[model samples]
Target chain A: MTSADQVPFDDRGLAYGDGVFETVLLRDGVPLLWPYHRARLLRGCRVLGLEPPDDAALAATWQAPASGLEVLKIILTRGSGGRGYALPESPAPRLLSRRTPFAPAASRWQGVDVCLCTLRLARQPALAGIKHLNRLENVLARQEWQRADIAEGLLADSDGNLVEATAMNVFWLADGVFRTPPLDACGVAGTLRAALLEQGVVGEAPLSVETLLDSELIEQLFVGNSVQGVWPVNTLTTPDGEPLRRFSPTSASPLQAAAHRLLGYVPLSGPSLSGEKR
Target chain B: MTSADQVPFDDRGLAYGDGVFETVLLRDGVPLLWPYHRARLLRGCRVLGLEPPDDAALAATWQAPASGLEVLKIILTRGSGGRGYALPESPAPRLLSRRTPFAPAASRWQGVDVCLCTLRLARQPALAGIKHLNRLENVLARQEWQRADIAEGLLADSDGNLVEATAMNVFWLADGVFRTPPLDACGVAGTLRAALLEQGVVGEAPLSVETLLDSELIEQLFVGNSVQGVWPVNTLTTPDGEPLRRFSPTSASPLQAAAHRLLGYVPLSGPSLSGEKR
Candidate 1:
């Protein structure tokens, strides 16, 4: 889209990353987990001090994809015309959407190799959890690896606490309990992560890289998000290509299966592919 | 301007804040401190892994204001079409500019009131010092106060180290030495701050709000940015409207005068109004 056809140059979202976004998965032209997405978008608006559009207005902005699995990315900005950091009195919030085709990889569903990123997420309790646009950290972390085999890179906070993957929330089975890092410090509280937490499939905990690398303590690991379903982590490697931990990719773990079911993801070929049942 | 007339909705600047910007002061259509602004923009591009536009291409984007003291804000984004955090291999950067009328407040030059923000800046060395688009911290801090008299707000890092003002760099005279906080951890490394440091007029040091509030140690305080020049902070107040420290606003300090001289600011009335001497 041309500049005139899209966001204005003076937009606060373009100027200061003063906005929040939601990436929703579309199944046969219907948005999956839309209620969760809407809730998170409203929460983000509250955190950023922007007056959110009402449910009717918000729902009007969504457009059904042509067909099949697609990604519907919605961005809500504080709108244009703010004096530097000072916000305008009555901000005219703008909602923008983009739809892109999504093709899920079967290998990712079975298992995928991940790497440890060198970049650490800054602890900003105010902006944490909400998927605001200040995502240079994630961009930098994602740039750490270029190998096709490395599906994702995990990030940690400045305090060395494992936060999440570059684009997804991470969870691991420890002592027969599925736990993920708390987003109280820093990390995007993924919609998928929240759904799993609500379903009592996972719990929050302080996860450390050192502790997670010990396979004996935590063997089952996976990463997930709203648009992309859960991907079981088969191998974990450092930025320098040193192997940290490895898991058997014999089959999708019970947690992964549960997440896939919740996400409405249908495995290409597997006995435990029960997402269609939902 | 319409969205098509300005930044595209898909522009990475709006999508992920994957960009850097510079605000320059203009006098009679001539940009002040153009070199410093250019250098910092280039530095920001490097930090964000964005390919810097050529000098000619960069200069082509600047549109001289109608006349007088106007603000020219130039934003260079990593263009559009990046899959989430993953950048496009051959990225196309976009240069956008906005010109606005700037009226200097005579009282701000004399002395202005500032507040201690409850919102703390997140320490991210990777994004620190560069005037990148991820400025939600500044936006949040600026929202902490609404009084017209309060011209700015001072921010501290999570570690309680005084970083900078909402939109300006702060400096104080402590132990007969002029010092500002180092931008190694957080805060924007402003062009004026760099110019002052380069001219040997100011030095860098870690400052604490507690230490700064102690009048005996730090009596002279000021805040500055490229567009507004130097503003002598007359009083510091808490968010609850409680006075923390008050300084004599009889006249501008020598440091402020020096900074004004470098910034090409002509005061309304003052004995040491020597910005025109240059």
Candidate 2:
């Protein structure tokens, strides 16, 4: 069925969030960093005990838009007909694809303000790192802010460790080393975050709000995901919009530039790369 | 739309588990403990920031089967259209209803075997008690066993405090008092459990697996939900199927009988009740 087709009412994804999804960046007619997305999707299927999608079906679904930058969301649910949370003996997994127009503002790449969310994520190690459909925690965190200027909200696990943004992975340059939170306990391991880690551009480290607000230690901060490359954190604020700290919106750091390159993001003006301009 | 109809592709419920649901037990043409279910559903809507379903619409959806006991599942989603987790400008919530035949064996009312799931639920107090759709933990916990004989799987929070069964709230008679685990940390506050608490038949208390296995302190164990009424726990086993403890199966205790009465469950042959026979 096409992406616009209605899903069965009894689908477990709608009932119990029994599904996983991937948001891929499609520039022009090509999907960026698809291998990583595919791997994560497979891992999610394995974790949820769902059968992997057929290669041909997945390829057909990933057909990118003819042109322009867009967001392609792929949702794979354990298809309908299971008794409550119980799995069906012979499962038919449904794959849905939808593409939406996306135009990231050029100014956002330079810097964006973020706020700390009051809703702390639960430490669910079993469901962590997989982009499953059970995203009520993120929904609640996103609801904490309503300002048009606030680009995202940062979340922490119940233990007070800084985890991730509502829709992105977080990274900071501290003591001349780039680091991000480890996702062993909670947080979605974004594809962009994985690429940075794989390229040895970012290291995993436990961070807290105290460490993040410490201007003396943290030199720079940024948030990123597969859909939107990386947006430098210009200022950090509390849920009440009280400014906690402000980082200068300087030129992209060497590590941030590296991350941008890995994500196939070419800055609008600064550096030259072989890709479509934003 | 009827339950057999398809849900729209963009439904937030399918996309992000942004919804809540209620399972009402319908005996003949009457819904048992509906007020409790309605209150919980509205509470869930408030917790998730969704518009509550219209009373008339809800009443129409809850039309019970003509005869016999059946499960009436009502799902209320935050409707379609949202930019990621951001709230829609004007929300249009969707309410869906479905019914399935339910036939709980009379023997189960006497006693049933249960097992401990290795999966520990993450403690998220913000989403605790309200039965929203983010239930991957329950799905994973249910996957811990495939044996049909194991009626339910008991779960504990990461802190080692017993929470609830995968699909039912748990209670035990300890020192001549009925107590259940508090849902402030995690676990769904079931409708039947609410009824028992409201009726002053059961109290909330922290419970541990060790305490449950203790034969001297714990006199009897039982599990209940809106759908299945109550079933006595005859045996508790480890994930590996090793017998942890066994309690003698006697006729329904006073608390059990009270819970049954509150749930409008009438035993097939035991005590007389002013309700349709199961």
Candidate 3:
């Protein structure tokens, strides 16, 4: 949208990352995960002491069909607070919704490779897991490696504990157990992770570099975020050492099969890297 | 200025705080600290990897005499970047200049009460000290204390060491030494702090809460930011302890005197219990 059609510069989002944002994928004009997205958005608003945006109005704007896959962005800014950090006694939040075209499949779904980034996530229990705007760390982490060939990076906390990728939550399968790092201290609690947890699909625990080195179980792996539903990890490496013994998902792994089924990916969509037909 | 007359939303400044900005106080249409502000603005651009704005063109717009104290703002966004944080392989930054009537200075400037906020400045050595747009900490800190009577809050790093006020650098006179926390590890290297340091009017040292209390040398105190210059501290208290002693400048303290001169205040602006002069 043009600047004229947008909110003022005083927008708290621009001023301070003083807001929460969500990017939902819209397929043929239908928002894929409305309830989950709205719940998180409202939860974020509560965290920042902001008024919730009108749900009906937001849903209406995204209801119109658009060709291919589109991204519906919801930016909730704490409107404007005079010139300081404190929330206004009464806050009138600014909620903005806009949609833009995005690559429908491979860029997000078809699975992308990732590198382990050197930047460590800071520990901020209060702000942890929320999609708040203070994202310089993510920006810096993403900038660490800029080759078009490498799609994204897996970042760890300062203590060498696995956090998540720059823009996605990570999952690793070892010994037939689906595991993801607990978000109790840091990292965002991804909607997909929450869904998987509720469905008893994956378990949360502290995953560390050494744990990966010691674990023998590996059937498949992937990272997930709200915008990018899930992308398989084709290869993983770090300067320290190669942690995984073999780095490809088993063609017949139940978890992978279940994930594909749940995400609506048919076998004809793509074959495994080993040229095995799914 | 209203949002309509200016730059676009895609401007990187709003997107990533991927820009440099300056807030110069204008009196009778003339910017009071133009040179310092300009220098810092340029320095900020350099750090953010953006070219300096065109100063000649910027000056042209400020030619008109404005009424009352005006706030002149200059934002140099990395013009625009496409969907990512990597500086455009090659970038041309956008420059936006605006002027707003000075928001009424809090009457409590002399001795405004302050809360010790919960937010802590993250240690990002690379981005620390520059007033780039990644200000979520400040936004969060300011949001913590909204009592109209409390001027601002003093913030600490995650380690509970003093950093600065929500929008300004802080100083305390302890044991007759004019001291402020070092900014190398975390905190903004404010323009005012730079000036004070360069003039050798204030001593730079690591200040801890323990040191602040034990020294007990405070006779007067204040916080400094570009927009409002130096504001005297009235009461400095955190939940951890009783109110700290206040310090006022005298013939012996060139630093406080210099600050007073710089801010155009007569010697020793008395402390205000609520930060208001009255």
Greater-lDDT candidate between 2 and 3: 2
Task: Please report the candidate that would top lDDT against the real structure.
Answer: 2
Tens digits of lDDT, candidate 1, A150-209: 989999999989999999999988888999999998999998899899999999989787
lDDT-best of 1 and 3: 1
Q: Residues B115-203, candidate 2, lDDT per residue (tens digit)?
A: 99999999999899999999999999989998888989999999999999999999988888999999999999998899899999999
Cα lDDT, model 1, residue A180: 93
* Cα displacement (Å) at residue A133, model 3: 2.0
Residue by residue across A73-141, what tens digits does model 2's lDDT show?
A: 888888888788889877887888887778765567767889999898999889889999999999999
Q: After superposition, how far is residue A172 of candidate 1 from its true place, in Å?
A: 0.3
True contacts kept of 2: 0.83
Using Cα atoms, each model's DockQ against the true complex is 0.77, 0.81, 0.43
Count of steric clashes across candidates, in order: 9, 0, 27
What local lDDT score does residue B93 receive in model 2, on the 0 to 100 scale? 84
lDDT at position B246, candidate 3: 42
Q: Is candidate 2 or candidate 3 better by TM-score?
A: 2
In candidate 2, stretches whose alpha carbon ends up further than 4 angstroms from where it belongs are: A1-4, A268-278, B1-4, B268-278
The Cα error of candidate 2 at residue B169, in Å, is: 0.6
Q: Is the docking of candidate 3 incorrect, acceptable, medium or high quality?
A: acceptable
